[model samples]
Target: MNSQQPSLAQGLLAGQRGALARAITWAENADRRFPQLLEDVYAAVGRSHRLGVTGPPGAGKSTLVNQLARHLRELERTVGILAVDPSSPFTGGALLGDRIRMEERTLDPGVFIRSMASRGSRGGLARATVDAFDVMDAFGFDQLIVETVGVGQAEYDVVGAADTVLVVLCPGAGDGVQAMKSGLLEVADVLCINKADLPGADRMVADLEEAVHIRTAGKGLWMPPVVSVSAGTDQGLDGLLEAIQSHRAWLEAEGRLQLSRQEQRLDQVQRVLREGFDHAIWEGRGLEGYARAMIKASRTPHGAAERILEQLKAALPSEWAQVQEETQP
Candidate 1:
């Protein structure tokens, strides 16, 4: 982040919290030097387990994440939390108020919590979520928790970014049926019924357990474990941890975890490419005026888009030619 890379990259590996926060800020802002920072810390990436906690709004994801951070801290594991929230319409920036929910954890030296704005990204995840996770992972956190905006049922961004996806549901939301309808069960590695102290919690748990059994029966796939937890009272924390550990153990066996991580990295690569190209074409090279002129000349939208792509393709490095066909839409 400076003239000397050692000050930033080495600082991160040296366990400096300032370096860690600055590194994540570089990611959030899409700083040009971010690629270099990543190169400096690439060796430390892939060491942390990223847990994505998501569900419908008001499912108490922040409180659950708060408790989960404490749980991991009790085990003496360092934790980094990324809470992605909806962008403020006025500022187009993260409304940092959500940080208050995890305020207690901030007092602990081992825990780092950052609130990010969704910035209109689909599935309630910021486009930079993966990058921020990579930075946090490189900073030596044993565990990383990504808490989504919890906008709704379509949260595949978490599924792609997190190694273990915990879909949190609660009672009185009719979330069991909602989860089924929204295919939340399909993406979840572990199903958590939060607010277990509330009425109808038992019935909700039973329903989800039966659903999981029914869905995975005879499929030979890892059936998602259904666990209920009352984050407010801290009940069923061990059960929740056990369920998560069971899934993690399964992923670790037979190199499945490595395979899964490779797939996730592939997704990250595509994401980086798309965002990079979008920025290059639309934000630089005067393509906006070119596009406007072409459109004003009565060119079809698709035709103008094709010409822009042609310009981009021509400017690309020769080494990228082989992959052009596959990458092009």
Candidate 2:
């Protein structure tokens, strides 16, 4: 946490590709120096395109991400991949098997890859994914691809952090259209029918197109185009890349790109502030006092939360005072 340490983190943030990998490591761990490192990373960040890839399991998101990285590298862009994997139930460690799918990029100096374990976070993305994105952004990567652990519909937290979101789906997945109805379909900037060579691929595409049309009936914004690709054979990659770039162009033309980035940064600030408040509330002797209060108010959980918030507001730093007004009930 010293000035020298943060200076070193800043140095690493500015280092070539190796700096990206190191930044990811620093962001993922809960080191005490993390806050300072994050500040340094944010201070050095610039305009980097962040693409979020999400879908249900078996959607071939990993394959798509690998292909996308290769495509970006071909275009002479420095690429960073943050692949989110679920933690092993027994070992409590990430499988980290994405490296196998991304073998082609191993020797590519322009590409940096890191695997993160979800740790059963509610969003199916590790809490540090956004921080890792900023670190990569600050390290001068032109493109940062965040691949979510697409376990369920709610795993679509990537949309808030990404400039363009690709919701990848495999053909013939049971009730594909129904899965999108809950909200995921509405958030997609692009829909990818990965593994398109499989049977029912066409049907899935048709169904998704109809569903998207039906859902966005009144909205004038461009409807998300569905692109089919067989990642195994590298089919339709060019079209997919074109679709991704087209969405970026659309966002820029519509003036949504800068808006999206601003929203994402503010969202992160809110989340960080909430976490700081929560940490301060639970630190020291308050945890024991809270347990006693909880036991006394067994029938109503509200008592402890209300009391905690009041205490939190009173103890918060001056900067947090401005946030407490909205955060407090």
Candidate 3:
């Protein structure tokens, strides 16, 4: 462990809010001390139920999340919220910050809220979102909610990381057909039609219900429930919460919670490995010069890429040689 890591880990374990914030910052920046900090606190993770909220930009996702957080606190549950906002073009930090609207909960000691910039990361989440969630979980929050920037269909990555994914859609926002077209239904554990009192809300709900039914009819798969809510009026919020709880109960009863978490952790491992490889091979090993040299030799980009792959394979340990040979055509 590094010099500052132990103290940080101890402070985090002691449930210090400052420690939690700093730890998340370390995760966000990919700081050098983060790995050891995580290692020291990893065992405390997995206790918090991660809920991911995402959808179209005007879906009222932030309002719904605020309502949900308020309701959870009413139940005496400690909550940690990571709101991933769009990046500022220049600073690469959260543009709206949105924390201003969450002022009610901001002063509540039981609630820990952080806004992260998308930082040009795709899949509706900042690359550091899960890492921050893990640290928040280790800090002993009973529930953690992740709200994505809701850029579009590609934002499904955040849902994959959560225990339950709530895809919120408001009526007349391209209609429910757009949801189906964008493949949003495929990732929804619970489909929340917010602004339920709107003119087309019922039609939107019906469309989604039919879509979910058709998609899961013969597969014996769990069909995501379509629930309606008016976050603005605080109406039907209970039904949304009930749907989330029902899904959680189903996962628990079917013994699938651990399996799902394991899969998410595996995905995290793959992401971390890819990042590490990019840093090690491209930056540490000076592979950029080699690429430039190959281009200077009049090689096409694809040809140069193949040459680089060969070099990478050659540098691998002897144990991989036979496997590499067998895979080569």
Candidate achieving the largest lDDT: 3
lDDT of 2 by residue, 1-329 (tens): 38655665767665756555666776677556767777766767757888999888878888889988988888999898889988876777777787788988989878888889976566767877888888778877899898888656566678767888898888777665575655678779899999999998998898888888876778877688899999888999999999999998998886788888888878888877877767765777647776677658755667766775677568758877678777896
lDDT by residue (tens digit), candidate 3, 1-329: 46889999999999999999999999989998998999999999989999999888878988899999999999999999999888866876566656776788988999999999888787888889989999999999998999988767666787657999999988888765676787778989999999999899999989999889888988988889999999989999888989999998888876799989988988899999999999987786578888888877755888888888888878889978788889897
lDDT of 1 by residue, 1-329 (tens): 26856679899999988998888888888888889999999998998988999988889899999999989999999999999888876778666566778889878999998888887687778988999999899988999999988756566888789989998888988756765677788889998899988899999988888788888989989999889999989998889988888899999999999999998899989989998778876776657888887677645998877877787679879878778877897
Among the numbered candidates, top TM-score falls to: 3
Q: What root-mean-square deviation over C-alphas does model 2 reach?
A: 3.1
Pick out the ten consecutive residues of candidate 1 with the lowest summed lDDT: 174-183
* Lowest-sum lDDT 10-residue window in model 2: 174-183
Candidate 2, which segments miss by more than 4 Å at Cα?
1-3, 89-91, 290-299, 310-329
The candidate with the higher lDDT, 2 or 3, is 3
What residue runs in model 3 are displaced by over 4 Å at the alpha carbon? 89-93, 318-329
lDDT of each: 0.86, 0.80, 0.88
Please give the RMSD to the true structure for each candidate, in Å: 2.8, 3.1, 2.8
List the candidate numbers ranked by TM-score, top first: 3, 1, 2
